[model samples]
Target chain A: MAYTQPHPRLSVVSNSSHSSVDHLSPTTTSRFSLPSVPSLHSSITTTKPGPNRPNIYDRPLNKTRSAEVSASAFAFLFSEVVQYTQKRVSGINDLERQLNTLGYRLGTRALELMVWRAEGSSKAPKRELKLLSVLMMVHTQVWKAVFGKGADALERSVENPDEYMIIDNDPLIERHISVPRDMSQLSCSSFTAGIVEAVLDGLSFPARVTSHNTPTVQYPNRTTILIKLEKSVLEREELLK
Target chain B: MAIFSLWVINKAGGLVYQRSFADGLAALTSNEYLVLAGTLHGIHAITSRLSPIGSSSGVQVIEGETFKMNILLTVTGTKFVLITSIKDPTADSVLQKVYDIYADAVMKNPFHTPEMPIRSEGFDSRIGTLIGTGQT
Candidate 1:
């Protein structure tokens, strides 16, 4: 503060009109010091800070910022959506199908945004991909968007080359669903159906999306969206690489 | 006013849901309720298209002086039938509210099975209270 103060000849003290820089001609007003300031003053001047911070912000460590959202608001909106789709549908299949279709559309939009976010000013995941590579994209990109975490596992079907399943432990979509007896067979994982569908579709691997419940030790609401890829998709994967 | 019954008929005049909320209608077998739904569905269709020009075919109020019969039809050719002996000015509002509840809580629910009996969690419990209160 003492070294940076302007020459007394250019004294302007207004908050908005400040150009607070001055040099000591006679004396720059004896270095103003508080009773408990001697120790703090030396530390502040000696610290080799990475960069000089602007006056607009507080100390570097205290300047953290992030957007905030209310979880209850999201839950309420989701509840309304679930209620609306319940009106005309007949069976469990239809309910799950609707949720899946909704999830798939959202998945497409999320995938696009995620790619943009990750690839900003940097080389992104290139076009060519093995099945494993695609799974990684879904894990790191799509899963983060949906559940705030990547999927638990992506397993290739042992019995069938055309089949793969992305496992989500405690899927967010199933959180509000308390299916009734009339819909005893209905699983609310269909919302994830749409998301997984979008990922496969984006990867040029056309597939059917289906959600089924798999209760477990850690997460009871586990959902595995089974993606059965078309034979042509495999061929395209080969040709692209 | 006791709610005599509620029926849901598809466009094809098939019974999707039928339940008795009162004791007036002679107790019918499960098969009979289904048949009643089917029969009412057919009658509703005949009445809707029976007109040469067009038909409003909805909320046909049958004033029973003490009680009232209400037959409501959706645009998709589904009918919601409610029979009650309560005469109140707010009866129509109550009925409309029921329809709104069904559309929002039941129709939009991703868990609701299409063309199936309503089994949504909020739909069932909430609609149950609304319908139950209206009956009293």
Candidate 2:
């Protein structure tokens, strides 16, 4: 793509034979160069073609293709993402945060697709209203649809009314990931947590989802993702319940 | 007399996958097939070592009375073997296509742990269609 420099139009008047005779002289060289004139309003204008794909806003975001992708390919790509995030950050927290941010974006789109796919040929699933119902949807339907298995368990926190827990014996995203010894405290499962958080936030439930590695003798890679709802969410839940 | 079966042996001489597409031949138990795969792997290594010239390119084909088996060893040491009727002329190319599909369907699948049994539905359906097309 050639980018033309913005230059004011130059107008030149030539005196034919008389100017031709004077053009040879050193003093007349100035005639060839146009004086720099200030452009009126300085409109640096160029036409760029509109994007080839249809405008994102103009198209409905609900369509989904029933396609399967190789899990190994996804694992390799995800590993590279972790490496890339690791290179940019100084510490584990920063890396985990970047991964969470990436997962958050994916979660927003995945939630839409999951809801559409699950609702089937009929109208979309009724907007998930109650807190417990949405949590059930995620634990059973969404988790199974995404991972090919329902999450191992879902339990409400007995100590705190606003807190909930979703447990997975083995999360698919971290199946191939073996974190180094130094970053043992770091669980990349935050990415999946971010996804859960996005789904909840999309349903208007403000919550923070964090991953905890509470491994047991049986389930070595067991993960318990804690979802802490905002104070207003509990109040609203009480009203709705 | 058509495409009969296929086997995928991992680098370590373990049978990772086996599928029979046609029925005329007698079927072996899963353990017997595993033993057969290990035996073929040993023969491949032995023959490569016994090549008179310095070149030990390994086993490429085996022709019996009724069936022909073609082998294609990938650079990564994954072996793809195709068993077909003696008349099938393009067995090598079919095995090549099988290798390509394996790379895509088995290797690329994130759920597939290395050297595990190959059970991807995509892989199975693609192979089925491929062999079906080969017959007609």
Candidate-wise lDDT, in order? 0.67, 0.78
True contacts kept of each: 0.27, 0.00
For each candidate, the DockQ is 0.13, 0.03
Per-residue lDDT for A30 in model 1? 48
Q: For model 2, report DockQ.
A: 0.03
lDDT of 2 by residue, B28-97 (tens): 9999999989999998888788878797778888889998889889889889988888988878878889
- TM-score, B chain, candidate 1? 0.75
Worst 10 residues of 2 chain A by lDDT: A4-13
Model 2: docking quality category: incorrect
Evaluate residue B135 in candidate 2 and report its C-alpha lDDT on the 0 to 100 scale. Answer: 59
**Regions of candidate 2 where Cα sits further than 4 Å from its true position:** A1-66, A118-120, B1-136
